[model samples]
Target: MENPPPKLQVKVTADASGSEKTVHSSGLSVRSLLKFSVSATLGGKDLTPEELGELLSNGDGLIRFKGEWVRVDARKVRDLMDRWTQAARMMSSLGIPLVQGLRMLVNGPSGQLVQIPEPDEDCVMEPGQNLRQTLDILAGKVPVSIPELPSRLDALMRPYQKEGFSFLYRITEQGFGACLADDMGLGKTLQAIAWLDTLRRKGRLEGLPALIVAPASLLSNWKEEAQRFAPELILRIMHPSSPDPWQPEKNLRRKDCHAVITTYGMAARTSALADLHFPAIILDEAQAIKNAGSARSRAIRSLHGERRIALSGTPVENNLNELWSLMEFLNPGLLGSRKSFESFTRSLERGYAPLRRLVRPFILRRMKTDPALVPDLPDKTEIPAYCSLTPEQAALYQTQIDMLHAVLDEPDPAARLMLILPILARLKQICNHPAQFQGTDDYAPERSGKFRRLQELCVSIAARQEKTILFTQFRSIIPHLHDLLSGVFGRSGLTLHGGTPIPERQNIVTAFQKESGPPFCILSLKAAGTGLTLTQASHVIHVDRWWNPAVENQATDRAYRIGQHRNVLVHRLICRGTIEDRIDAMLKDKRRMADDLFSGGPEQWLMNMSAEELNNLFFGSPC
Candidate 1:
């Protein structure tokens, strides 16, 4: 009798959309096709093309065909059985032993043994048997392969790794929330780019739809850093120049683009693009939305996305309430209520574990302690120096204090408010020296112990070929310090203040940090404290102190941040027998009070301190 002819077979499966069908040219083996079809039908809801492929390969379930539901059976396909029988014949004809071919038989496409129905010393084989059948039979014998896990890097990442970057990646992979709390000068931008790169490498990123909301000033910086670190990642700056700010469709559709960098201003006006459903959203200088009730914050909250990352150096700048707003953005309920956060902060201050539990899972903070990843650091030592007021400054300060007292004694509230401006002006002048306002030729006839010490310190740093940064609250006094330093160190002194245009400010900072240029840059504390980098200055002098410790730390980071190779020495010049000392003490006490209030406890200072205590700090006593 003649052997049966090979049967023609066809297999069909649903496409990703499930609305259309795809027919494979060579029909799938019974076992494999059943698994693929079943998985497709069951896991078909809202599945992406890639996800559907994975589901079909791993799933095991019954499939319905032509209104008949059939459970997957290993022996169902006749073609698979015939293929295995043919494989056994080919092995035998090749002069292979029966036991050897039986060992090689393994399993067929249906996951069944490749058994030779009949064996004879001389059995004629059919001409239709082919090598394709043999391969399909062998495939069923192998076990399902397991995939490898992602490799984890053990070495510490850069200390300034932006928390926003890490948080985005963690939330996407682990479905958790996170916050990026870093001091200024730490490369938060770079960390964000790194996370994007990781996603790209894993093929998890598609359409590269990422949005970076930053300050208008830092938009260029973001563009520059993205170019430097992630050159391949396309960046489109979303400004008003585009045809339609409201419609980001043009920028969003670009093949090469990965991220859209926009300012907080633009994001507020054009929130319609939020529907694009970005894979990741990063808010740089996140404090820009510290006010939860602001339109900007509301705009950001309106955005829809799976991942949200907030970057800010001053996480709790003015109050712990600021942290609540930030956390609410990152994860709706991670930090709980404002009341609960207050409680948590109280617990944290008392070294309680609850604070860690609440924050650790979502917050990853790296300070300067990690040795492997931290950048070259400069030493920051606070030096206390006293300065005697010039006769003119002394006279002016005394007059102003007396006037302030007289105004305060008045029953009129408006008069008291008016007195504040003049007192502020006098305090400003004192920070510089009365000569700054009085006259150029005027001098502090009374020698200042702090001035003498500062001079000595300046000379020593100059001699050692090191640079210095002198900070004062008053911009008016920058010129005086420039003059005084110039007389001592010649043209090697420069001054930077708010009046300095943005372009010129950056230029001056760059010049001061140069190895062969000016050895000192005197800056108005508020102007140059937060964003500028001045690593060449191995020495930092705070001629006047600010009430906020975070502000002070920001200024310190200019030198202590990345690229400093030498130890940094910081000097806080205070008039020893003056209100400066008392003010410094009061500021420290206030910081402690703020810390206590947030750490899940009551603020004792708020209750205990009367109007008298507040008034005395600003007026009554000299240090």
Candidate 2:
């Protein structure tokens, strides 16, 4: 008869405070927080390590325990011992990450029911009581109860918004990071605030302050929103421009302070925030860290926080690579290292089912167009207004195109590559207006077809007394657009760009949002694209196309999001028979796959093209 096979039983025990300790030292392994051990049994008899060693030394196929003969394959027993030794060493050196531990519990080590079968061969792994409870929570086998809404919160949350808060609360309470990726105008900020306040009320914050990081432009917005919605929470802004005039580190540590807000740029530049750890950290417009290699991304990741929450409507604006960056920040090691993840994504089959399965539980996304979830959201109609170039604009555009062709013929490939982006920038300025390209103060609408089209649209919009918000990527053109729109609408409108003072942005927004306020508000796309509400405007006009769907969508959502009672008509002014027209067509063709992999605007893909391809794309006929 064959010798009885050796069976290994592995057990896991989780420390109650492991998550807290792990947050302080990101480099430490999960094994430091959890305990693991293995035991061997042969033919219903237990064999001690010494007895097994003796059997191995004797080169025997049988061992005795409790005066019973237990036959076993010595080689198999030795192999099991070797496997356990290696697992113990790894567990001691690089403990499993919290996310990785949770995943391993749900899906075995290799994502199967059996945990690493090749190594274990005939092993049984059992989760201890605490580990099993965590598994139950992760599997949604038991409901996570949320505390009642804090009475101090001034605003009543909509049903969907309340649900959003619950989702954030559940994941965060369990020490898992969350991504609240609701549609742009769906009040991600409000949901986040509600959750933060609830944490305070539930005593979950443990007397440690939470941290909020956002763009420089949105710092004031966060302060105002928190003050309006959760006034009971003592909030502080951590920037030199703050009126409090106190050192940020000292002010942030005040016992009365519940939370502190800072800009991404400041977080990267100042060492004051480097060593501080929070009970929680919230990243507004979290896509700011989409490039994992960026200094901002690295700095944000280095800050200590128990639970990380990211808020963004366009989380994966570009590709899966960006999604990896966001996930890495929220839950490190959940997707393995960057190189391994890149390899995994490359090997993914159609639909990327494995990666999707691994990440779906942590990210929550809702669309504004879902009537069942948001019945009050108004319709958004996008209309592309194609316009021809004026004679002067056409001459400048052609001249630049000829110069690009000449440059592309250079003997050095690197020299040819260096000139493409600047030429593209010049081409875009020419398409916007000849005066804008020529750097002149001429604001005549007849000088450029796009400006003429804008005048026509604004005239019609003004006749109906409907408000409009015009967006452009260029800050220099804001003054010109303001001057022209003032003439068309016969009223002094507002302008907010990068230069707009942090304190004045809210005032400018309030001015535009009033019933009898400005007829039009000209904004720089990058500065005011997000974290502002302009529902008062019924029309949104793009003075120049970004050739990036996510960015333009964000800009338009300023007027199209939740509180807007009127239908939003988005006007995208495209220069016909130019790079803008061709790129627009290419984006429309790629629209079907937008959710999975929409790349950045022309600035990115254009650089990778051959010189010949660039020539054709720049001067290509309208598709």
Candidate 3:
């Protein structure tokens, strides 16, 4: 009779000879001393290494060992043994790093899924005192307390913000990099600043100043926030365009400099920024380095820092590759090389849960909707305000569609492809208003359906005397929106686009927050999507779809964050029976996918579509 299939198990123990060692020479740097042994089990007992050797030599698919009959596939047996043998050699000699140990703890030591009825149940780890204590601390079972905020920290931290500070402090204290991915407007900046202050108070940052890399637009915002919250922390802005043009190497050497802030572009181009070592390197809007192979990402990785912190509302903006990039920047080799990670991602047998489990320890994500944080925040209601297209808009949109068809029929594919984005932009512009597409000053309320809807909404907002913020991707449309909103509210509102000087952006934000400030503010979506808090406004309107849920959500959070006393109403305007409507439908599915995978979708997918598919997608009957 045929015997039952073999049962595989992994046993892990702490080896003292290799106890918590570090090897900086070759391969992955070693840290923990966890030894791994793989064996086959039958009924209740394990087969010894000698018995497994005997089984390997056996010709039959069945083997009798330890006084019990067991069946095994010769190939699986050899593969398992070969994998564990290599792991044993590494663990016994140099020891495994904490990341490798964690990976092994989640996945088997072979770094592959073991064919077992239950992998978690079959594997066991017997940790030594040090490993056990570290595991307990990471698991949060053993309380590790961080120091209370010193009086120098001017602002009162919310309960969750304090928890965020502790998490950053604790994770970095253990020599692991951290990703603080709290929801936008939940105070990720404040938490990072608090941790830096704690390090300063403890004399951990005595000589080595911390480095903060942010977007150019947010450099001023960071300066303001650091000054307001942690006034004692001496800071310097290191950019050529700063009021005091920073002489990179010279300014950084000043003894009073506790932290240096620079833009990602400046950081990549300036060699002096990369030359010095920093105690802590914090990246705000960390998604800037999502492309692992980009020059910016390479430059950021080249900088040496004892502790790394990546702060972003949306860490995984595009795909798992982006997540790998962030992880590689935070902790090199934590997820292996980029090529190997790509292989793992493509392998359906390996699964993604192991990857998630491997990184869960290092990333701290807190949503605004969490039960713990909900009480401290006010309510937010998202309302979809649908609009119809005018006859003029329909004609303009159809003209662009026809133009795209003409481009599609071109003999040269590259030339045809080059026109896709411009054509798509025109199509979106037509959906906004015919005046916007025509480049005319005429934006009559009746020329566009969206304008009519905007008029109605603004009239209601003005009647209630409530303020609203308008966000759009196109800078040219800001003037048009300002004119329309000003006429409705009977007062001139404010505008912030890419052209707004960096110094003035903060001044505009500050002015808008006051009780008697402008009743409305129109902003370019990209420039003000992040790093600004406008909780004073009770309403937020998305003038057009960026087609990216992560970005649109960040824009809406500008008002829905910590300080607002009243409930917020978010208006997402959709133009019916157009590209806007179709993308709006796809947006829901994209959001659902992002929620499941922590990734995002880009419009590049549209460029790959066939002309027929494009026509059907955009010009087809809209639901």
Candidate 4:
């Protein structure tokens, strides 16, 4: 048998003016009408049939070939026709055949399929030739295959499987602004790191120039956690000794680091460093930029970046305006002017739009209770300890309260304000002992029912299989509590306070959390309340009360935050009949006031309550 005839290949060219040439297989037949019309479309009305034949014969030179003003590559057209015919044959073999002549199919791979137009149907199939190529060109194309992401991303994101993670992923992917509003110790850092790691895996991260603007105190902690969680990532701490701020690009390039952790102070003063463009910039403890017009805020705003993320547990710390500042940084013009933002916030409190749209896409917040992955936390048990003051301490407390009430009644507002610090100091001293602040060296027995009750609770916590943190407003009381617990339980207790030095604080807390030996830690309310993670202790004792609920909550968070497997028990010890009860009542009202004011809601009665009303709580006696 004879071999099948070789398929034909042709090259078509359009000249600078307008032209074409056609080459065909020697055995193929050409119709006279097809040849005449093809030449007419190419040369316009000027060329005759004989001239067109001559032009086709001289295929080596550039000729004017036309099908509108579009330039079609002949090689591309021929290749497309071959692919179309192959695809059609494959489809037919699969029991699906394309109908010819402008037919459409809804279930086709490209969603809809249309047949190629014929030459005589007023559609010009120029020098390139063929209905298959025309059809292939008309079909919309599919994108190239997307490579699979790294398998490690699943392991990395395993820690953040909460609904909040979806919100975070969307924010980073869509460049939407977001605030992670989770309470302290709810794993905000983990969520952020996971997001960054995803970006790295997806090849979206570039230059490896990410800046984590955090508090000076948290700089090292961030570095350690980043290293622990993302071992593959390289980190450089940007400090005064690191390198010249003017040359961040050069220094970062030299080290080939993926991230840099720095404090707000360093980021603000280092103007030269702000010039380098980073692909990803994250601000940890973003509340540091609460003042929109501050130097730190301006410096961060000046820093160039393709993506920006802000992380803060307290995004609306003292004002709603602070939230606007953060939104403005993430997406300018989204929130409009400060004045407009304030107006929008008013309506937003009433559930209005545009304002909600401006904020909803940018902020992803979750509470500790929101994470379904984590088991239910231990219920916070507030064991109110009723303690009676020693006779001397009781006398001193009465004397102080009386004087404070007198001062509060003074005509001058400044005089009344001046009395606050001293009154608070005296009250705190009385809770522990008169000697704690006054240095009187007078010994006082713990006679208050609240004090006796706390001692019993401490004994119970010490006997249990768990650990406990006892918080007191008076640092002087830490040693006393430690001594009391030591006398009762013996070497099973430790004390932590402000003077313990920054480096040793973490060490002490770690030891307490590990529960290798010690069963209790006595902590000053101010010092151990924030920043430190003490997830080992299941029980927290508030030996004294604070005026700010957030402050007390921060203290509770030390033990209750991430990693605790048991339910956290919180004890708020308040004296039954003293200034402590009065103050606690006042604080509840103050917290409501602060929340309403900061949330851009209408002011509460607490904000307008007179100093006389406050004085009445302390001195006028409950009816």
Please give the TM-score that candidate 2 achieves against the real structure.
0.83
**Which 10 consecutive residues of model 2 have the lowest summed lDDT?**
108-117
How many pairs of residues collide in model 1? 9
Per-residue lDDT for 1-623 in model 3, tens only? 97565554444454333233332111112244445555555454666877656766875555675576666566655655566666666556555555655655565223432322223444454554565566566555677767889765534888788888888977777666889999888889999999988877787677868889998778878888888898888777887667875566666556777788988888899887777878899999999999989998999888888788999989987778888889887877678768777876777465678777678867989898885885768888988899998988888887878777667666554565677778878877887888888889898979899989998999999999999999999999999999999999999999998889878888888999999999999999998888788888999999987877788888999898888788999998888887788777765656564454322433445545567766677667753
Better of 1 and 4 by TM-score: 4
Q: For model 3, which pairs clash? A: none
After superposition, the stretches of candidate 2 with alpha carbons farther than 4 Å from their true spots are 1-95, 102-132, 151-155, 204-206, 407-417, 593-598, 608-612
Model 1, C-alpha of 477: deviation from truth (Å): 4.2
In the range 1-623, model 4's lDDT, one tens digit per residue, is 95432221221111111121212111111111111111222322334556444444544323344422322233433444454444434444232212111111111112123332122211232222332232222221212122332455446444444345555554443333457767778777776776666656565554546777876556556666767776666667777534433246466554456777787888888876667877678888687787898887978877865567888767775566887788767765455567756764665544445444335546766566665645555555655555666676678788887777566656655555555656766777676666675765432345444556677777787677678788887776666667677765667577878676544655676677675858888888765676667888888888877655656777788888777777888877776557677655545556665455423321223244367775776676532
Candidate with maximal lDDT? 3
Q: Which is better, 1 or 4, measured by lDDT?
A: 4
Q: All models: lDDT?
A: 0.56, 0.76, 0.76, 0.58
Candidate 2 residue lDDT tens string, 1-623: 96554433333332223344443222222233444455665544556777656655655555564465545566765666566556655666444445555444433123312232333434434455556565555445767777778664534788888878888877766667789999899999999999888877766565668989998778778878888898876677877788883355565556777888888998788776777778889999999999989998989888878778999998988777788789878877677667767776776656576676667768889998899988978888889898999999889998998887788776555666677778888989999988888889986889989988888888899999999998999999999988888999897999999988888888899898899888889999999998889999999999887767888889999999878999999988998898888877877776663433335666556545677776677766755
lDDT at residue 305 of model 2 (Cα atoms)? 82
TM-score of 4: 0.65
TM-score, per-candidate, Cα-based: 0.62, 0.83, 0.85, 0.65
Q: Rank by TM-score, descending?
A: 3, 2, 4, 1
